[model samples]
Target: MENWFSLLQKNVLNQQSWTTREQLRLAIVYWIEARYHRRRRQRRLGKLTPIEFETIMKDPACLAA
Candidate 1:
C-alpha cells in the first residue's frame, strides 16, 4: 500500500495539477487501471499480470454473476 501511495505521489500528485476533486479522482483511477493494474505481476497469480490471469481464467458462467 505504501509503495502504491509513493507511486501515486510521484507519478500523479507531483506531475500534474487538478482543478477539481473529481478530476483528481479520475486521474488516479486512470493511472491505476491503465498502468499499475495492467503492468504489475503478482506471486499469488503465479507471476502473471492481473489482466493476463483474468484472461486465462475468464468463464462466461463466472462473469454472468
Candidate 2:
C-alpha cells in the first residue's frame, strides 16, 4: 500500500497542479483505475493485469477475448 501511494504521489500528484479538491480526487481515481490497475501485472495473476486475469477467468475459450 505504501508503494502504491508512493507511485501515485510521484507519477500523478507530483506531475500536476490540481486546482480543486474534486479535481484532485478524480485525478487520483483515474490514475489508480485507468492507469495503475490496468497496466501493472501481478505475479499472483500469472504476470497479468487484473483486467487480463479477469478476462481469462471469465472466458476460458480465448485469451485474446
Candidate 3:
C-alpha cells in the first residue's frame, strides 16, 4: 500500500484547490485518522494503536528481526 502522504495526495486532494495552509492541514488530519490512527493497535487497549501494540510485542535486545 502507498504511504500516508501519497494516499492523501491521491485521494483527498484529487486535484482539489487548497487555497490555504489550513485546508492542507485538515486534509492531512483526515488522512491520518482514517488511514493510520484508526488502524493502529494499542497495547494498553489490548493490541489496539499499532505503536502501543507493536511495543508490547517487540524485543528490546533486537531492533528489527
Candidate 4:
C-alpha cells in the first residue's frame, strides 16, 4: 500500500497541476486505469496481461495442469 502511494505521489502528485478538485480526481483515475493497471505486468501471469493469458489459455489444444 505504501509503495502504491509512493508511486502515485511520484507519478501523479509531483508531476502535474490541477485547476479543480474534479480535474484532479479524474486525472488520478485516468492514470490508474489507463497507465498503471492496464500496463503493469504481474508475476502470476508470467508478465502477461490478463487478456493475453486468457487468450493463450483459450486454445483448445492446451491442457490444464
Candidate 5:
C-alpha cells in the first residue's frame, strides 16, 4: 500500500524531468501499468488486474460490517 501510493505520487506530482506533458504521461502510464499493476497481479492480487479487484473492494456495499 505504501509502495503503491509512493509510485502514484512520484508519477503524478513530479513531471519536471520531461520536456513535454505527453512524454511524461506516457512514461507514468507505462510505469504504473507495467510495474505496479502487473506485479500486483503476479504477487498480492491473486492474478486479478488491479482495477477490476479494486472496483469490487472499493464499493461501500462490499464492506464487512
Candidate 6:
C-alpha cells in the first residue's frame, strides 16, 4: 500500500494540480485502469500481468482455471 501511494504521489499528484475533486477522481481511475493494472503482476494469476494471463487463458492447451 505504501508503494502504491508513493507512486500515486509521484506520478499523478506531483505531476499536476487538480482544481476539482471530480478531476482528481477521474485521474486516479484512469491511472489505475490504464497504467497500474495493465502492468502490475497479480498474485492470483501466478504473478502474470492481466494481459499475459488473458492470452494464456485463451490458448486451447492452457489448463482450466
* TM per candidate: 0.71, 0.67, 0.43, 0.64, 0.44, 0.85
lDDT of 4 by residue, 1-65 (tens): 99899999998988878899998899899999888877677789999877677788888546653
Rank by TM-score (best first)? 6, 1, 2, 4, 5, 3
lDDT of 1 at 21: 94
Candidate 6, residues 1-65, lDDT tens digits: the string is 99999999987899889999999999999999999999999999999999999898788655554
Better of 4 and 5 by TM-score: 4
Assess each prediction's global lDDT (C-alpha) against the native.
0.90, 0.89, 0.72, 0.84, 0.71, 0.92
Which is the leading candidate under lDDT?
6
* Candidate 2 per-residue lDDT over residues 1-65, each given as its tens digit: 89988999998899979999999999999888899989899999999999988887888766556
Candidate 1 lDDT over 1-65, as tens digits, reads 89989999998889878999999999999999899988899899999999888887887658888
* Candidate 3 lDDT by residue in tens digits, 1-65: 46756766786788688899999888878778877676766566776677555565676636665
Best by TM-score: 6
What C-alpha lDDT does candidate 6 achieve relative to the native structure? 0.92
lDDT of 4 at 59: 87
Would you list the rank order by lDDT, best first?
6, 1, 2, 4, 3, 5
Model 4 alpha-carbon drift over 4 Å, by segment: 42-47, 54-65
Q: How many residue pairs clash per model? A: 0, 0, 7, 0, 0, 0
RMSD of each: 4.4, 3.6, 9.1, 4.5, 9.0, 3.2
* lDDT of model 1, residue 33: 88
**Candidate 1, lDDT over the whole model:** 0.90
What TM-score, to 2 decimals, does candidate 6 have? 0.85
